[model samples]
Target: MNRIALLAASAAGLAVYAIAPAHAAVLPTDATETVTSCGNSRLQAGLATRVCAEITGTTVEFYGRVGLAGPPSPGGPAPAPRELLTTLSVEVAGAAAPRTQFTSALFTASNLEVRGTADTVPCGSTVRATFGVASYPYAANPVVHEVTVTC
Candidate 1:
């Protein structure tokens, strides 16, 4: 009877754990960003990260990605790549509030990405964005960039 009771409790615990909802991001999801041009990139510890920005109408979008910068060792076992945190920070010259988003917990496969946007920017307005990445515990890196695009 004790063995049966233990098994029943274990099954109930597993059911509750499986039914728990996952945490969702507060920011809007990206619409398939094509990182055609990368303004900044960092290669460190066999990992490569890139950050870019683009404008559509009055909205500005930012992107960040992390992947393997080099091949793994050909020794007995390959080292598993650690998780990287990606942050996209955007601020308009005249805007009151800055927009920022952080994506971690790893993206598809090996590459990781985090994206966000700043909206209502005027035509030919100067926008500042920073793309940052950190290893695991920390997320985000890189430099700041100023961009102006026609409406």
Candidate 2:
């Protein structure tokens, strides 16, 4: 479906989720990860999310994942994150804007994930590379990690 439709559906899901009490021995909170070469973890609603990108030789290897923040609750319905968007780009010398390499459609899952590799402009030099993701349900902001990777 389109983004507007997807967003509306997610909102409805949230409304349903709002009243479903978490099964808590202690409690669970959302854990999320942002743009990093190795990946970072931080989200809300007992979900954990991460994205990583690293350059090796002339290629960038990337990984993104979502999972339960803690052990499965006996009865709590964990929130599924919406992977709104993902993008990869590379800056070209003297170019007004970076060239787009990839973009993904919306994905919804408790175990959301993605992994792939893309060639950098070249292997001999440093290049400005970027990895980005826009997710829902607990993301404070969309990730837009830019880093210089040497091949």
Candidate 3:
């Protein structure tokens, strides 16, 4: 009888352990402030001229919580890549507001030079460029804009 009781207790404990929540790799689900570019120019597209601005700053923010599969082996941390994924430029806008949608990852990091022409206005206008990984969402929406410099 005692043996049977011990076996049942062990089984129950095992069941509880299995049912309890086990820590899984937590992925970061948030947005972070990145770089900014300034300086814009007016250019002719087809019918009307367009204004393009450049923003300089840390545009890529880390997303997705990265950790070791198990506790750091031998007290050493697991290997994590320096760069996770490619950065996508959302839009270029004035007044620190992102006008374009951050949907496509079409563009890439350029040589910090102005190419196209912006038909809006010239430098001295407050322009903001927002970039981020499209997967993650912002929790608190940190301040992305600093000084409204010319660009």
Candidate 4:
């Protein structure tokens, strides 16, 4: 009878062990920022471009663009044509009223440059800005030249 009771106890322990949950290894969080050039299109003789910057471990995406502007064409031998002007608009993934959109006064016909700092980002957050430009009526397929800066 003692042998039978010992065998029953051993069977119950084995069953419990079989039904226990297994522990999984924890993965470290990624905090790197990834910048990508999403391509561009010609909009009424002006180029429209986009750059996407993603923050790791979160669903936040920073979308930036240099607004469309007409291509600079030479007037005549007397005076050269002035370069086009446009604004850059940057917005977070899901927020409103805190967006940053600045129109630059300095202009260029074939090249676009954007320079600024993002001060509204959270501390320890990785911020990156990508600037690009495309020349119209010159290149067959307007290719954007990109430069990325980390802040």
Q: What lDDT does the true structure give each of the candidates?
A: 0.60, 0.48, 0.29, 0.40
Q: Candidate 1's residue-wise lDDT over 69-143, tens digit each?
A: 766567655555466566678887787676777666543335666667546566766667777766755444464
Candidate closer to the true structure by lDDT (higher is better), 2 or 3: 2
Where does candidate 4 have its weakest 10-residue lDDT segment? 21-30
Stretches off by above 4 angstroms in model 3 are: 1-78, 90-121, 134-143
Residue range 1-151, candidate 2, lDDT tens digits: 9999999999999998777543211111112322235435645333465655555444544555555566756787744444455555555345457655455544444466556555444433333434455555533332333334332
Off by over 4 Å in 1: 1-36, 44-46, 74-78, 107-109, 136-140
Query: What would the TM-scores of all predictions be?
Result: 0.59, 0.43, 0.24, 0.34
Which candidate number has the best lDDT?
Answer: 1
lDDT of 4: 0.40
Q: List the residue pairs that clash in candidate 2.
A: 30-43, 30-44, 30-45, 31-42, 31-43, 32-42, 32-43
Report the C-alpha lDDT of model 3 over 70-131, residue by residue, as the tens digit.
Answer: 33367665433322222222223333444333222222221122132222333333333322
Q: Order of candidates by lDDT, top first?
A: 1, 2, 4, 3
Q: Model 1 clash pairs?
A: 132-140, 132-141, 133-140, 133-141, 134-140
Q: Which is better, 1 or 3, measured by TM-score?
A: 1
Show model 4 residue runs off by greater than 4 Å.
1-33, 44-81, 119-151
